[model samples]
Target: MTVENASAPPSTRRPSAERAAALAIQHLLSRQDAQGWWKGDLECNVTSDAEDLLLRQFLDIQDKKTTHAAARYIRGQQREDATWATFHGGPGELSTTIEAYVALRLAGDAPDDPHMAGAAAWIRAHGGIAASRVFTRIWLALFGWWKWDDLPELPPEVIFLPKWFPLDIYHFACWARQIIVPLTIVSAKRPVRPAPFSLNELHTDPRLPNPSRRLAPVNSWDGFFQRLDKALHAYHKVAPRRLRKAAMSRAALWIIERLESDGCWGGIQPQATYSLIALRVLGYQLEHPVMRAGLASLDTFAVWREDGARMIEIAQSPVWDTSLAVCALADAGVNPDHPALVKATDWMLGKQILRRGDWAVRRPGLDPGGWAFEFHNNNNPDLDDTAEVILALRRVQHPDPVRVSAAIRRGVRWSLGMQSGNGAWGAFDVDNNSSLPGKLPFCDFAEVTDPPSADVTAHVVEMLANEGRSADPRTQRGIEWLLTEQEPSGAWFGRWGVNHVYGTGAVVPALIAAGLPAAHPAIRRAVTWLRSVQNDDGGWGEDPRSYLDEDWVGRGTSTASQTAWALLALLAADERESEAVERGIGWITLAQREDGTWDEPHFTGTSFPGDMSLSYHLYRQVFPLMALGRYLRAVQQGQSVCGTSDLPR
Candidate 1:
């Protein structure tokens, strides 16, 4: 919503990308924190605030200030129809609307309030609470608003399953695994807190309650899971008391072990909430250190302002943000030995995971040498962060090259070891794409498995080549995998960013950086794809809806970040001399704000492919700088820029 375009007609003399890039560089340097890192506001849906309020409600720690502030923020996001959309300017989301209404209710809004009525109307019109995701209904079941029997069956005994089993605890992507572990304990305990009021009005047909209990098709796998769930429910009632108690103890221990030093579980709200509630159900007191520390950790997620309104960040982005800032500064010609760069690199060096994590479950015996996406998520370092961090480190001439070299070598080795059999790299786990979760009746959202992705794999490939491993068999295998995965249209599927533009942006530069020449047909085809999708305004754009519908790929109004991705892709494919590149450069300079950052309200990061999205608030500022810096570097070097050399590698 903050983005701006020219109000007047095009000028004869536009600021060149190179000149504008210098202005942007100065703008970025002025915005750095005293601690030598950049942390932009990470904006997500109302669910975070809604969930926080619910967590507070469960803990009975409602404070007047936070409650009202979060309420005001939620109210501000309600649409004309009194519903909430997941991303800005998107259509209403049923689950988001239900949660927002519940949070507002917990904040003391009367049920008959106009906004509440409208939200209820929207919910009832869209198949009511039953139609929402399993996670949503599970939240409701806690407050006696929904029946526990109607929910999916998750036994605490899952924690005791052997790794050789199909649905072992490690089978899930780390985030989901964290959620499930604590949630299984919660499900087994089945604690119900009394609600102040019932939600009768939101139901579609009051006579037909407990929707989740309805039988699924007996012929389908979903139906079989339903039957299995029903059978488990029956066992829940008759299971031996001592065995169930032991299973709960095991689940609690599992959760406690993974809690971060700050007491946040996996550095995400959902896991922390589940951990807190599960422990409480198991008789942990509010005064217990785990409970106290967990409660204190949530305050970090709150973004309170002088306006007395607050928003919740789903998770922190320091590691990801700090690494990107390093690359941007390096590309803009900052001295690698600058105190800012030194401080950042030193901080990064300290964050590497030298100990094995859950990722090693599938990759047993692989040495631990990677970086997490957050400041404290040591239990789950990702391939993306590790690759990007190594790339950023390569750009900096650190005072201690021996240490930096050691980190790079370790990270590259660990990262390569985590690559899938297909030669692509996954984020947190290798070969994590077991299809059983998708077939479950409870899985209503997007893909949850951490499968190999083009964007992540490309970043790894670029990092590998930068480390002078281009001749290695592993590197060759990765290149062959990427070639096989290229789309028919010459674009690769972006499993992490928005869509084709981002995938193409990542792959082209990586292919080039890995020694594929611009003259290669693969590079030529990719360059053609980028040009063909260029917007009339001379930039590139892709909608978040592109994940929902492929038809929308590369077809939205241009934003600073997506345009930067397109421009970087073009520059990588040696298209700096093309008109498409010229116009894209023109668009970036034109969109630059007085503060030196470009406006981008649209989300470009993907969490679960099509379902969950995020807007990294600093992306507009950082990416344009990298794109322009790369363009300038390429023009100076005659053509082409390396993905891992600089420009947000």
Candidate 2:
């Protein structure tokens, strides 16, 4: 394949390598599942576009009512300048604004429609076409709204870098790495063509005349990374023919091996999905079986309804949800023989990874022993899942000796191996704190890195303690780190769940497990902090803003899940007999619906502190079960129980 002449006017010539890449990508696509779905990055947020589109489709409100309602929601979100934010009331992001505007257009609003004008005006006002993120620009370029040269190069050769090197494939966080792999091929090819429509009004300058030079200052980290990328591009251009071919082939195979049957590299998340598509455009063929299956898999990810069509989540949470539910019920004092408990245990036992997954890289020689968020994501198995799964399994009566023993050993080993040198554990991988990845200018968005954190470490300690191995040095070190990590305000910064409530809920139990006296200063301080935050509603709820604003700690409309979390912390501290625990349990019981479930409208789980939020539907059921079970047990032991009459009006 000949390099496209940067000096020569844009040519129609298709490089042979580009064709080969496309064929390879298409081949990858053919491997998708019979169900039309492609797994990749879901790109989660408070205003998840996927959720908005899903609601529209599910309600079958394609008529003016639906349009008007959604439009009202979208319009209300627009800033004074007409741009919308990915996060609540934050700076306007071009991609979010673009998606929102497109949704509005699909809602039957015309370009000149006042709201439409306002959005377009805002897009232009924010450097319009020029100021968007690389991913955003890539989408626009795909349809000819933006030029290819304006983007950074992503040569596949970068994948060949050794794990020890800076900017190596391994240096990137898993989420970022997944997208970058396919993007490398796409960037190197730099394919551009015309689109069906013009986005002239969306740009501050004519698309053709718009400057394509790198945006960040050369002295800045982003600029440095960009320059390094350009150098990689030059190296790819002149590399030995044999070496280049081998690198590309290796990269292609690496991607193919990881392709889930659902046409997604991992599951139908957007990053993997888009990467799959980019690979296809690079010349992968459909009949190659892998590509064919992958393409078919993409179809399963599409969710169509009367109002509009969007993507179905590539991943689901039956295993994680059920396990957490089982634990919650058991902790709440539900009989181990409860039908739900038995079923959940049976399901979880069947779901254990008996063979090693990608985690084997850092934790080699350990048997596969962790649970994944989705039933299928073997490669991205989580440390938290392993801990929680083991905890749940331990509570089950009559677990299979062989399976339980084996799974626990594997999980314990994995968790221990995942501990960083600093004696803490991260959610997924260990030692994922490269200084370079986050410094890249292109990574202005939050969450380009992962490090060991207090919450995950506490979970590890609790799990180890349950295994009767709390005295182990590794476990002791983790406990020590957690004790040190507590905030001056007496709370631990929760990395995975919502704010202080989650951190406190996790820490108090872990401390208790580690043999902290109930009256220990740290324990008492945590108890006092929780009690102070209890709402008049006799429940506790903290907004996501708690991640940003300390003053907002424990402030929000009381919800069943948060209340349960607070209750769990109090109970773990031997405070189950306290007025606060009684009130908290009452609030949860009162909030329960006739169906035995509680209302949980808010997303309580977070990934990259303050950026992406998640709602585990089972959080409401499980946490309350845990709190109530603990409370009931304490009361059965002659501790005072809060009466239903004491619940908030």
Candidate 3:
């Protein structure tokens, strides 16, 4: 908390790291709310902003201020080529561009305007509307700009499928299921609002907007789904009227049942947006309590900036942010009984989900005690957040030890129960890796399956180790599974964060904490991999494109968050004295701003791998402090960061 210059030379390691860590800890503490929570802005691409405007237009509730502000934000995301991309420094994406263009049009931008005209030209050159994804087309069809028949058919009757069925609601990823169930009603009803303006300029040819294409070979998955879709379309014309009505009613009820206390379905904009549309189509009036509450929840996602641009967060992350903040603060020399740590721990305990959610479908006997990513997503407590929160809680000496212990026990039990048969943990659901959802023609945007990833499994493993369960049979199995998942290049795939850096950063520490030796072959290979990929400037950054191109793996311009992640892995492996480690620390200290924070403009967080990227504003702060704190501890204690376990229980 004292004033010091982090700009000290690299040779002066202790002073520089100490000053930088102190500045970060103070800055982070300043950000904590009175109720003991830290929330950073969760930023995604322009699609959320576009979809928000589209939702208002569909509901006939467009306000001038919101429209202008949203349009400004959307325009600001446009690329030099007049197209929008899903992530920073990525190629132009057809779907994102189309959505942003439509949102700007809704804000009253004329097609003939210079910027608008350039975007239209780019859209036309890229096969126009036909080249966009199915989700984008669905939005277009709602306004009569595209025909409903051209899109994939999603019959509401699918909701009647048994839980044992391949494509049942439970089989899809939790986020996808929330949106899919409501979309089934939308697809069945096919209601279209009248368009206020024509999108002829966005079409390659107005007369044949959706050109027909030949299906793949019958033996292929695409062909089978294509034929199935055709049959479903045929069923749409002749299905029994009574049965269809009953199915739509069932789907509508399903959507309403999952609404959280704050009226959000999963604290995600798309899920809430589509659910509202489904209910509205089924005759739910705008003034109805459920409808009104749902509408109000969408407003919470808007993050109005000082420049008057209104951007929309795809999902909120207070719970996730707070848990990591606690870990960072506690690691950075904050006292175990410090008020900040206690309040954060108390807040986290209160946020634990005590009721069963959709994850219980597969584990009916397991108790509910996991944590969700958002403030009010009780129905979907993710394993990643739960594991991290438990670790954070373990670091604090809370006033009520019984309560903390009880919470930790429940969390560990739930986490252990939620593990897949393969001995790994996914973010949300267990064994939610059904391939049917991805093969379906309707799901072309977000990842529909929730498979176990190294990062999540690592967190759970680390949490289990901290709880003295390191030698448990289940923990050993998880460790074995992680060993098998290592890539030939010595990195693991990062499902939730940006590429190899995040995954390797997460796995190394967990492995080390679980009793793996510093010189283990796997650890050595990972260290070599990390050092080989370090930026010439001595920090680490991985571009989102690594999810698609192997050439880009573990390569990008340095950022504070990513550099910290790599350093954490190194320090955990007893590499505090290595040149790579020292250079990384120097980069972090020199990169620190006068205000005790680092500026990270790249999309370091992730949602759907290559399809969607995110920028968690707090990642730039929390991770660096955590890494620095661990490094200082290693140096001061004359031991590995993991070996110095005298902080707290």
- TM-score winner among the candidates? 3
Sorting all predicted structures by lDDT, with the top scorer first, yields 3, 1, 2
Pairs clashing within candidate 1? none
Once fitted onto the true fold, the runs of candidate 2 whose alpha carbons sit more than 4 angstroms away are 1-94, 103-109, 125-127, 205-223, 230-244, 261-263, 299-311, 548-553, 638-649
On lDDT, the leading prediction is: 3
Write the residue-wise lDDT of candidate 1 on 1-649 in tens digits. Answer: 3233422232421345656777787877777777666788888889989999998898889899999999999999898878998887778999999999999999999989999998999999999988888889888999998988888788888888898787887777888888888888888888888988888888998887665455767998878888888899999999899988999998888888888898798788878888999999999999999899899999988888678889998888888888898888787677878777888888889999999889888888899999998768889999999998898888777789999989988998899899898888888898888888666655667675788888898999988888788888888888998998888888888887888888988888888888898888888888888888988776677887888797897788788888888888788777877777777777787788766778787888777776778888888888989888877777777767756643332
**Preferred candidate (lDDT higher): 1 or 2:** 1
The lDDT for every candidate, in the order shown, is: 0.84, 0.65, 0.91
Would you estimate the TM-scores of all the predictions? 0.96, 0.80, 0.98
Clash number for candidate 1: 0
Candidate 2 local Cα displacement, residue 71, angstroms: 11
The TM-score, computed over Cα atoms with residue i paired to residue i, of candidate 3 is: 0.98
| TM-score for candidate 1 | 0.96
Q: Write the per-residue lDDT of candidate 3 for residues 7-126, one digit (tens) a residue.
A: 245469888889999999999999999999999999999999999999999999999999999999999989999999888788898889999999999999999998899999999999
Give the least accurate 10-residue stretch of model 3, judged by summed lDDT: 1-10
